[model samples]
Target: MATTGVITVSAVVLRNAAGSSVLTVRKRGTTSFMFPGGKPEPGETAAETLIRELEEELGVNLDPAALRPLGVFRAAAANETGFEVEATVFEHPTVPIGGPAAEIDEVRWLDLGLEIIPDDIAPLTALMLPALRADPRER
Candidate 1:
């Protein structure tokens, strides 16, 4: 019998500061700028995963009460690894703390009008970019 695999659950945090958007750059081996998030551990909910990953990657703790679930999206693998992912996107008010954790190479606040976001991000995310640019809090 063939074994069925589980989908990886991740979150992409959308944080806006002073009318600018926040993004993180992974190491050279990874794809372009991405929101802070990662896979969910066993028995953990998506929201829990978002909170934990954000804190781990960005060094800022998000108030559980402040997380607003934007929506869920799925896309083909962005990296060479062929595993598909189901990403739960969220909009949150965040503040930068200390330096980013080891997983993150650099972090910056980008102009909402940035013209060169990577093409590997999900199509659904790209579709929402226009609206997000207009209102970062829009889910």
Candidate 2:
């Protein structure tokens, strides 16, 4: 049976220099691509969780200071049916290059310039696309 309830996680957006695209990842057994992040350990702050998750999933160690608040968002869980995701999202000041690690199966750059987001993205990724496009840094 599918698990139900809200999953609280810390996610990050790592954009290319042009900010036209962001990095996304797919877990080992999942189809949808979402921001690279995971659930926090007990008592971990949002930033702490993101920093640890980024390094674990992508092998990119991030400074806590480099994470910019990107606002909290909620969406349907991509891999877990009957559950929703509440993500405390952050944006890394600079894009980091890394490969799949831990439970990650693949990594890809998601183009923010597309008029339509691909169906394979998680709901949180879809929700953030418009905002990312309008960001001044993309200019």
Candidate 3:
């Protein structure tokens, strides 16, 4: 199905020291696992939105200057059905320090080659598998 519309935002690919795994989080009352991010506030840039969201949802502080552009990614919106999520993804190449802040209910580290992604995954994450599998950092 064609996307009804797009919800623009930013996201972080929080990787471990070896970059072999990526982190995913589940929001309160939500079954799907997705990257930590949210819709941008009016006039807010994508990076800024991601920065705020990471702190709000994960209790982790990200150095704004450290956010690396990972290009724009697109997938069906997990929460808003019939729509697409337009994500300006960033890379935070670090092992997150804290966990379960704000609306976050659970956290999981997805091993690119080993773990079978659950059906209850957000769209962007569903679209990310091939890249994660081919990523040199995951090798």
Candidate with maximal TM-score? 2
C-alpha RMSD by candidate, in order: 4.2, 2.2, 2.0
The C-alpha local distance difference test score for the whole of candidate 2 amounts to: 0.87
* Most accurate candidate by lDDT: 2
Per-residue lDDT tens digits for candidate 1, residues 1-139, read: 2223335666655555554665544533665455667778899888899778777877778777888888887654444345555688777765655566757776655456778755555443455567678774432
Tell me the tens digit of each residue's lDDT in model 3 across 16-128.
77777778889898899888788899988988898888888888888888888879988888888789889998877684557788889998887777657778878798788
Query: Candidate 3 at 41: error in angstroms?
Result: 1.3
Report the Cα lDDT for residue 117, model 2.
Answer: 85
TM-score, prediction 1: 0.75
Arrange candidates by TM-score, highest first: which order?
A: 2, 3, 1
**Could you give me the TM-score of model 2 versus the true structure?**
0.93
Candidate 2 colliding pairs: none
Candidate 2, residue 90: CA error in Å?
Answer: 0.7
Tell me the deviation in Å of residue 126 in model 1.
3.8
lDDT against the true structure, per candidate, is: 0.63, 0.87, 0.81
